[model samples]
Target chain A: MAQARQEDNATDAPPEALRAEGIVKRFGALTALSGVDLHLRKGEVLGLIGDNGAGKSTLIKTITGFHRPDEGQMYVDGEPVSLRSVAQARALGIETVFQDLALISELSVYHNMFLNSELTLKPFPLLDNRKMKERTKQYIDDMGVNIPSIDTQVGRLSGGQRQAIAVARSVYSNAKILLLDEPLAAMGAKEGAMILDLVQKLKNEGQVSIILIAHNYSHVFEVCDRVNLLQHGRISYDKPTSESSVEELTELVVAEYRKARTTS
Target chain B: MAKQAVGGDVGASESARSSPGLGSRVAELLLRQREASIFFVAIALAVYFQSSNSAFLSSGNIRSLSEFTYATAIISGGLVMLLICGEIDLSVGQAYGFAPIAMYLADQTLVLPVAVIVGLLATAVIGLINGVATVYLRVPSFIATLGMFFFLGGVNVILTDGFPKTAPSGSFLTEILGGADWSGIAWCLLIVLLMHILLNRTRWGLHTFATGGNPVGASEAGVKTAKIKVGNFMLCSALGGFAGVLDALRIGSIDPLAGGPNIMFFAVSAAVIGGTALAGGTGTIIGAFLGTVVLSIMQNGFSLQGVSAYTFNVILGIAILTAMTLNVYVGSLRRSGRV
Candidate 1:
């Protein structure tokens, strides 16, 4: 795996997996994202931090093709493309793990993993359950996602497990650019650590570029290679994680909060 | 990773150590499957009825029971699928009433095959209307199909002038459809088998589950939930109409008032009793067939015992309520993995 990653890096691969320039999204009279610029480098984890209503979700949706940006340019693997739907974005190897995880609770773990992209028996429309179950088990083992059984309903799993399954699904789908929207929200310490470890594992694999939208600064500092802060509908701060601290990030956000109080 | 390994090890050891008793294992199996419990109940009912009345298991009575079971089984086969996908067609019975009349009118001018096709198409149109109103126009299926129920019921009466029409007879197609004593049951079994495979083995079935379980999540996963639901509605109505035509051929007549709201109630009741959730996302076509069997047996058994017709309705009402209550409890157990 290490040799393959090295060979990939040595090849003429794009430096950046995804890049957005001057992205603007408007909802009626309100501008959710205005002149937003962001980039995720190849095989890098980029932490995106923002206050509530800071257009983090809007920006992520626009990138995922869930929402059309009124004005912007997006490049995947250094090639300019226009995405009109989530399906289009997925076709381009861009997958989003939404905050809700987008899993049918009533479905089994393997079924949830292969949702909308099911494997079928050749010459028949029947689901190839045996193949899917085997693949699902392998993927879960690869990601170190601990679940009692692949046949267990997704609703029976914990929040952290569900989150890991969602991430694993995106990874297994051959996602080149993954955007995780608040993956650790509402999770306990153990659960949050599990997701953090998964992210760290993905970072170590060095296969996919990830943009993790998070509120926790320490988590961002832990797994992210670089950090970007969204404020006033644009990236206001960008720095390598090595040069940044949780205190520095907190102070910047707090200062903005103080400024907002004074103005309002 | 180490923690996960330890957890797995602990789980394995715990299961190895327990080696649950046979009685507990059987309990676990039954508790885990709503279908199994219902199956045992149906068997027990059969045994009790056979012991009480010698005529209960006779060929003649069994044939009558099958006649009752076929309609419910076929109708609930489609209704259960629709319910699993979070939709319902309360007007299925109306479609059932409408199809035979449509087929009879078409037979006057067209060939038998063409007439049958026209009948099925007429019901498919009803389904399409229900699908469009519920999915595209954003009307709740309950209200939309309820309107269809009254409208189609009125149309059936107006078309037949509130009189029963004599059914066409002596054709091989008609004989195979439902004219033979065992033909209706055969068709019902075939439909149930096909529906069961469609639900368990097909992508469309999985998509239906996903759509009903979580529409937003299903859509996010790229499943066209609207299309799945609309397709289910169409299937439900078509099945209802097919069951109606079968009944018409068997009885050799078509009644404008036959298979009205009562048939819809019985079909939905059978589906629910068979373990199909009204809340959606979970169901079994085989279970629905068994549910129809249980209901038909009960109705047949009671009449064989010389029970009053009025008392049969009261008993059916209680049975439905009891089955539904049990279903909810069983569903909770399944979700919690207690079984």
Candidate 2:
């Protein structure tokens, strides 16, 4: 938060890791996101806070290529990019950990981590079981968290453990930008702290630009360098965490929620 | 706790072991009611007839039953995969008709292997067209395959002039496809066995489940779900085409009208009975095989035991309905947190 305030004072331009310019999205008669601009720098955690229906999901979807924005452009590492599909976004080193977790419950930890992207031995097409299992174990060890086993089915995993796996999966993809949609929404205080620690760990590693989206301003304020508040499909306030309090962000979100409710 | 103790003795290592076991149990219950019920009923009647007539298990009757299983299982295998991906191919019956007729025509009019290749290519093309239309063109597989059905059926009628046409008698190719071994299993059963492995053990097999489980989720995981669906549709039709060729050889004649009807019903029946969901996800190739065997055994037993042939239809209908109901109920339980 201190560093974010310093950066804000030094420059008002977009950060280098990720950027969006005049992002606009519409669904039939409704505008989901309108003329929104945001950016993230390497190793910086950006908290995206918005009321329900304030286009948080739409913005994430558009960035992740699940839904393309009707107007505006997104850039990764200062290069123009068009995300036609989720696969394209992933290939572009932009990994999104959806709130649903999107994990296959029946598969083992390693299998779910890799999913369709299983490492296969060419010429025979047999999966490199040893490599995948070993890599999965290494990731578990690297994360330094409590996981039962690499062979554990995701369904049997606790919610916190499942979230850990989702994080591990995105990190394993070697993503330059990690978009986490409410990673701690359904988690307990302990789990939320563990995730915050993990986010901090990743930040310390300085590997990627992480975007944390949550309605919980407390958690957001704990992890983010900069916070952006959305109201009526536009960025209402964008400032460093040092300059904003949890109460201010909560008031903004609640006000926007009331306004949207009355308008609808 | 006692149940847990008993479960341990019963080989329960998984705490959620109950879920998988319950899934298979539900599958078994549905399996018993659908394709297997008729067989069970037929077995009961067969025992009665054997006790009374003493000629119910005759080799002729056994051979006839086995033959029915051969034809039904191969087609059902492909259909089950299609069902798992939430698609259908109404044109398979016609594909069945066309493949053999085309093969016969190719051999007699063109050449041997070349004609066979041509017939297969034609079938593959039909599959390709269906895949493209369904995946890229974004049409529901039901409507697209239904359109293919009418088109292929019409083509069959026009090509064969509305009657059965005999292929040149005594071709070695025909013998291999139509002829049976001492075990009474056709050579095609080997192909079916290979398909079983391909569906159960391979990566594509898992991909089929993934594509069906949630197409959006699968795509997000980079599964190329559309391509997978297209490939599955093509694979189903290819198998149908192959089955058609074998049917021609077995009958020693090709009927333009041979395959245009009842294939969707039979294949879907076999699939549903085999524990494949019409809603997609969770299925087995062996179940499909067993399903066909059960259905055929019932029909054969009815004919052998001198039961009314009309009764077989009623029994088949009841069996299918029972399987479907069981499947629906168990599926609902799974969704409702009972399983």
Candidate 3:
């Protein structure tokens, strides 16, 4: 029945842009992700909140095709899709901005922006550096990304600026579904505002879907349309941001913590 | 990427005005690093040696020094590529000798040209073995290539019974590969120029830098790091093979122990002194070329001045140590944001 729904393409649109059902990932004897189901409709931001070792990162890795699930079903636009590599996920218009930012420290901003997807003329694999640099400058300006120059190495920048670059890179990849793993950490006031605005713009366009992993409830409350609380490798709470309050999310986490403490 | 950035010209005029200053500052920073230091050391050594023996600056001595650096420079090109890709092939030294020995063994049956091809094929096979052992077998390149080094060297010795082969003298293959004149130097220059372009201007080269800088990052970015490394291993072995053949042609004979680990050590030192980081992610082909020149100059100058072998080794060792220490220091400066 799940396979049939995924294959149904007669309708004009699918219910969800990206979805995963029963994702289970194991590393040796330990299960990183056990039966985690996630949902994000088109043009929606789903905030993923979790405590330490709550398997948020593992879920992201599985979805991004970094760590293939040991057992699971992943669907794109209601079509069953198997993601075997990051490149495959990218081809499906699913781009991820990892917390590490995935930027080469030695490379310049422009180089990092086009790290895997470089511009090159046909018949020869030489880089079009001029075009790449120009395009990167254009992107930074449009996004108001606080960068000194396109030529500056990403490592030389402050942590906030590096985060800005990662967001810009994902946004530039033209992703239909973007995953940001703690993108706001170390982000400065101005840069954070710019990234927030960028996400808002993409959300409003009704063309992109987003899944953000954020620790702060306030940030999640601001822009995320819905929130899912991942507890112990499972979704313990899921609701629209309007239906949920910070006090309620905090109470839920605190209860879980107390329960775990008492049980242990 | 996303329909191209719409408003890209906001600060174009302003940054254009500062472009000249920024460009120069970047260049100044680059020169402040390891490359310039080694260049100056090479020049200073030249001046000092020339002052001692007027013949040190003679055209004959200069030509000889240039020729001496040819094989080392060619092999150093591949070594630098491998090193930058986060692996090293110590077997290039033995692979070098193996190429010529393969040719020599083949020459006993086949024609000279056929023998050269066989020799080159032999090196490629050795390269594949080294690459497979490292990439597939999960052996670290240092240990894998080191094992190949001894294994190949022993094979050359055992097969030849420790006797040198008379290099084929009159064939067209001999004329070209042996460098009837300074052709080996030309080959070295061509290889350096090609590799320089490959390392800086091409996508493959960018992938190389990415792989060396952060293997995990590069892999995540869709770069097949394993394939890149394996390709580099093959390229290094091929270049080693070419250099081995060229050296045999020039020397008029193939010494059973011609391109030993000691010689590979000198080539590696040239790369390190030239700013190719032993730790990877940083290096320049031109720097490697100049480093080979400096090493050759030291050897030539010291020998001309009647320095004993023991003293020459000691002095050369000290010089290399000092140069490499400087390289490490400058590299740290880059990490600290000085570059």
Candidate 4:
């Protein structure tokens, strides 16, 4: 079935933004991921759903180069690549917004926006704060993210605002493939809505391909173009969102729980 | 619930925009700036001392006051940076004690300039060891540096045989480094200024802040947090050594017991009183300089007033407690945006 899908992908479809084939990861006596295959198409949002400890985080970490799979062939833009570090992955325009959002709260919004990739003055080894602040303000405003001021410390901003800034930082850095891990996990309805709006806007632009890892089936259906269910370290179900429903996804997950109950 | 959260954020920002009364504004400014409040306290103490003892502000007394302030100021400047980057060197004072002895021993075999370099290199190596132990060996820096403190203290006594040694005489280097009346303060101000620039304007400083603010986050963003931390430890120890050499040059003697835990405590206290958080991620070199000034003023003022040494310690303890309490209170006020 996976081979047939790959043939279909090769014949007629949008180009693959990223593809992982036969990925396997092991830790000591435990196997976290065993022969997992996943594909993300260009400019599409793929919702990745899995139960806790189903190797969801491990897979994301592997793809982001925070982990090295024992066996895998990963391709970026149809070109095979071996990623050794997060910096190398970033060099290839792949960015991950982890669950914690990876923001330094003591730093100002502009500073956080340009944290590691700071702009420096040409003549001196000094940060160009003025230019960075100005550009951050313009970029944030253009994205329609409501921040009090660019100079405010990120810790002072609301969670939703902080998440927006994280997403914006990734987008601003020209990420071609953005992976968001639980972007709306603990967010309120309004804040979740805000993030959904931002994702929808990015989807409309169709420039950055995204893989959103979420637990809520409704959230997955809201913005995802396709859904991939990870179970027992494999993609158990892959279908377009238009061809699937929340009830179907829930039943698939519940059936696993029922099987475990009977076997135990 | 969501509406309340959003409304709360908007309300806080809105209140920040709306002006309060003039009195509250000034109060707010002082509360927001740990340095400004401490500077005022330093000035107030100076004024009181001058009024009580007419000789307090005399040129002779001023020179002595600066002599006391320079060593602490220079050491605290480095401590501020270290603390901001989420590390500390309890052995800095030992580095201070060790450098002059190293310089003195090296002066017998090498040029004075070469000997000074050797002295600084010795301290830098000590810093490197501290960094290595903390970063790679996974030792907590507090315990690592404390162990270094005791280790170096013993090394200092062994090196000097528990006796003071006279610094090399009549070199022009001494005159410029610390022998001249104003040279110590000159070096102090210059170092403080450079440290201020390094902390506020440079990319290294920004990375240092980021590394301390959130180590995991900073590393995820590709910031070399381990390098930044190790580099800060080296810089702190180097500065401590520099201050020790300067004092030895000025006094023409190196005491094995001098610049030990007392000086280290003073430097740490000054940095904290100046607004450097012990939890790290925030600090100011200029604030640390002002903090040194406050400490120096209290010590000088009490001595001029004929206060006993024991009584001065009592006052110093009380003063630290008061300053820190006020710092915490003011910090909360600033966070809540209520002065």
List the DockQ of the predictions in order: 0.77, 0.29, 0.51, 0.72
Q: List ranges where model 2 is wrong by over 4 Å.
A: A1-15, A22-34, A66-74, A78-85, A104-110, A127-163, A185-201, A254-264, B1-61, B180-186, B332-339
By lDDT, is 1 or 3 better? Answer: 1
Give per-residue CA lDDT, model 2, range A7-125, as digits (tens). Answer: 67478754588889999999999999989899887778999988788899999988889998899989888899978988788888899988878776645688778777778777867
- What TM-score quantifies how close candidate 2 is to the native fold? 0.82
Candidate 1 chain B has its poorest 10 consecutive residues by lDDT at B330-339
lDDT for each residue of candidate 4 in A53-77, tens digit (9 for 90 to 100): 9999999999999899999899999
Candidate 3 lDDT over B226-303, as tens digits, reads 888888899889889989999988888887887879768878988987888877777788888888989898889989
Model 2 scores a C-alpha lDDT of 0.78
**Model 2: per-residue Cα lDDT at residue B74:** 76
lDDT (Cα, 0-100) at A199 in candidate 1: 94
- In terms of TM-score, which candidate is stronger, 2 or 3? 3
Better of 2 and 4 by lDDT: 4
Candidate 4, residue B250: the lDDT equals: 94
TM-score attained by model 1: 0.95
Our tally of clashes for model 2 stands at 1
Go through the candidates in order and give each one's C-alpha lDDT: 0.92, 0.78, 0.85, 0.91
User: Candidate 3, which segments miss by more than 4 Å at Cα?
Assistant: A1-15, A27-29, A186-194, B1-34
lDDT string for model 4 (B1-339, tens) is: 999999999999888769688987788778777678888889999999999999999999999999999999999999988898788899999999999999999999899999999999999999999999999998999999999999999999999899999988687988888988889999999999998989888889998898888989999988999999898899999999999999999999999998999999999999988888877888889889999998898898998888988998898888788878877776676566454
Task: Give the winner by TM-score: 3 or 4.
Answer: 4
TM-score of chain A of each: 0.94, 0.92, 0.89, 0.95
